[model samples]
Target: MTDSRIAAESWETLRARHSAKWRRYPADVIPMHVAEMDYPVAAPIRAALGELVASSDMGYLGPMPEIAPAFTAFAESRWGWTPDTSNARLAPDVGVATVEFLRAHNVSRVIVTSPVYAGFWHWLEELGIDIVDVPLTSDFRLDISGIEREFANGVGHLLLCNPHNPLGRVFGRDELLALAEAADRHNAVVIADEIHAPLTYPGSDFVPYLSLGPAAERTGVLVTSTSKSWNLAGLKAAFILGHGDRGTELLKPLPEAMHWRSSILGAFSMSVAYRDGVEWLDSTLDTLAVARDHLASELKRLLPSAHLEMVPEAGYLAWVDVSGLNLGDRPWDRILEEARVSVVPGTELGPQYTQHIRINFATSPELITRALTQIAAL
Candidate 1:
């Protein structure tokens, strides 16, 4: 593969590409792959979460210690939209929080924009809810008219993904407002997954679903966690934000303990991350920004036949147009066997995305180089 400017750059960029190489490698084989990064934890996060774990303090924790503040602080500091911390509640994960919210709302049939995280269906099935699939257009965005058709048939809930995964398309405010209007029309509660909001590209704006306007009070939105930005996925802590009476009413179906799974260290980490993580997050995002550029350049250099798709301003994950590659049944498996790289397949997300691949570019420079080299050879 052609060389790029990974060196003579930021530590985040250098570390990301290098770490992946070492992590999935034999002594000699490099790994410019995987979503996991090679960089060490930010000092504040390392210090805060480390202090508790070092003390062997693992136990059940209470609700997120000002998770709303942690998140809203990021929002206000970055997006200028102030999310009320008071509405924040805790859940083990975003997917869990979503289904739990739906359960409470007595929603048996939920509608989701297709080719999402893919696991949304797993969660829906686990919760025994039927799904309404609204596939995105060829452009990887909502087929708004199709959604309305589904709404006409009836939808009890709507799941929204801001800065949607794989494709990294951050919905515009007007787009979100239109979605909210549809859910409202169907009498469906809107459950949004804004987990990747923090990593939003530099210029793209993230529009919160519930924060839409007066009509949003009746809409149920669940914003949670800093896992994507801070690289804290294993921490298993996330918060759900709801509005007014509508928020409270959605919880009538579940027992109180369903909301009690928030772990102590996770909550502590969320607080510490929010309170002292501004610089680290900025730096980490800076690293991700580098990864994005690296991936873009490498894609052009190596896989010009592939559709790089629309990579919104933010995010390290890429939605590649592997359709031109034409690998069938299991493109991810094919890439792994041919290239020895593990990537998330689009098939899991939906049939429309079968030839697509979602690559996590959060690794080290060497790893990125090597991963691209392998793909170029393929």
Candidate 2:
């Protein structure tokens, strides 16, 4: 097996790779804003894609029995929960699956926990739904009482981001159970985006929303993928999982196109990933655990004034409080222009978080060091 713990390619080689993370910025800039990792694809996944291409087997997607069982096996092994494979369906990606799920239910408004994934806002607005922001509490956990308040005001859908983006706090099991109770009492539906669940660090616990209990099973739907977990976003495929009979029935009316829209290559790779990508994933997680610590320590050493909102509990992104640096309204701009390090500006996350910047730290320790050093120099 290839060593997933090390980034084999140098900056010059990586810059020429075919991905937005490389092409979006100039060569001199360290592009650490996007979620794509710096590691190579898993050997099992690479071999699967290669064989498909070599045989000219690239065709439209069709039913593959392995999809559901593969995910079920992974979920059971990783999180100790097993989803009913019969409750799963395919979509082009998480975004499409989310919007389509909302549309199918005639949902016109959603309760969103903000300072969340920016794409949640985009997807809701594109569906012509009103978004009610229940921003994360100051500590970056779900504001359950605030969410309950919003639910009381007539919103039927809650768009949840588990193992949240940017801040990277993996929502705890008790919090999720309380949320499930609230949703059940208010008759609200939860559409959880669990795409980042697979990448959660060793000590963090990522509780699947649908696995909470009977109340949660009735009120929840999960949209997840190998895209974020396996760096297959460009390939375009994801799954929508309903908890039980009620939840499954709710998802049954989705347009047939949702299934057809998924890429054949993506579906094949996703199955391969869940089944055979565990070794690679374990190695990547080991590497990221080190990288995560390295980034945090480097930030303290180089930029003591800048505060990390929370050390990420999962994934590679770090949400930092750059307000202490006093670098104008948008600190990311200064960092990009002066430090030549591209990071996501806080404003894009939400109006309440304009003083922050989300940094992707899933790279070599050397690059993490350089990026922090540059920011400090600014």
Candidate 3:
């Protein structure tokens, strides 16, 4: 039997967690919202963080020469793709990297595929950039023709979510290559958010935008972090990878403080995660796969009217359509009030998905069962 790396504590014990998922709701609420996992930090990452704290090594963050190489090894081993280290830079997180890269290129109007990671809206709004919404196809893949129309008309940037959040759709190489070609033809930059790439399941192919083709290498900027995969969001470390003159120039305006903003503990822990945490990661994946199927079965058995739009291709979040539940305007709000289960509101992704709710299933099967049962009973 494979050892499971992810296991959830009881509700009483989990209530003590200092994270937002636990603290945001009252004691009666079961949090199934936040992307962070309920699993304990990996032994390697915990050990790295512990050594830093013990030796009093905490100080202003400096260039860690190890991050690029460690990430290179992890990427190659896991994805069979090797990144160019010279083209990589560290930022506090993926949000910061996206904002700075757009600012560097003086991007005023950007296109986003909806529904998207909610944070993408905040990043664009803060920079005073106009948003052009290109909603995904009904099947939840990119609307390529829509993207081309937006790009040809004046949109200069596109924010892409690969192994997309909520939907968990791992985009294919052909689709990504077509996007890269469209961007290159229109001289538009594609900022690919690939943080969830590492979490993809066994058979799903996660094709990195940068590895798509020459057009992709020229037109895409890849930003990713260890936060999502290793459950280390609080650590605050991410990588910005670019290639050639276009890639390098787009990255040049990142402020010097970008590096300083990352925690020293985060930097080292990230390196350790990439270099030595593979065994733990594999174990975690196995657990998550079983949890994913378990949640689907539970939901199907309990709520026959509810629809899981896509059996997730990756990650623990499940985007469920509750349209059949007969819950009004804010179905998620009703779920929380009646069922006492906290889920991410569908409207956060976009106004069109008001009947949908996102559930974080990265917990013990018992918690998933409890949450689904409560919803079904309501």
In candidate 1, what are the lDDT values of residues 112-180, reduced to their tens digit? 887777768888888889888887778666777788777778776777777787678888877777777
TM-score of 1: 0.88
- In order, what is each prediction's RMSD in angstroms? 4.6, 1.5, 1.3
**TM-score versus the correct structure, for each prediction:** 0.88, 0.97, 0.97
List runs of model 3 lying over 4 Å from the truth. none
lDDT of 3 by residue, 1-378 (tens): 247756766777788988888899898998999898888788888988888999999998887998888988988887888876686888889999889888877889999888888888889989999989999899888899999999999898999999898899998887888899999999888999999888898889888888776899888889999899999998898889888776777777878778888888888888998998888887888989989999899989988899988888988889998999888888888789999999999888876788889999999898889898999887
Best by lDDT: 2
For candidate 2, write residues 1-378 as lDDT tens digits.
Answer: 334455536877788887999888888899988889988888899999999999999888999788988988999999999886786889889999999999998999898887878888888889899999999887677899999998899899999999898788899988899999999999899998999989888788889988888989889999999998788888889989886688668898799899898999999999999999988988888888888898889988999998888888888899988998989988898999999999988877777888989999888899999988888888
Clashing pairs in 2: none
Q: Would you give me the overall lDDT of model 2?
A: 0.88
Worst 10 residues of 1 by lDDT: 1-10
Model 2 residue 236 lDDT?
89
Give the 10-residue window scoring lowest on summed lDDT in candidate 3: 1-10
For TM-score, candidate 1 versus 2, the one ahead is 2
Q: For candidate 1, what is the lDDT?
A: 0.70
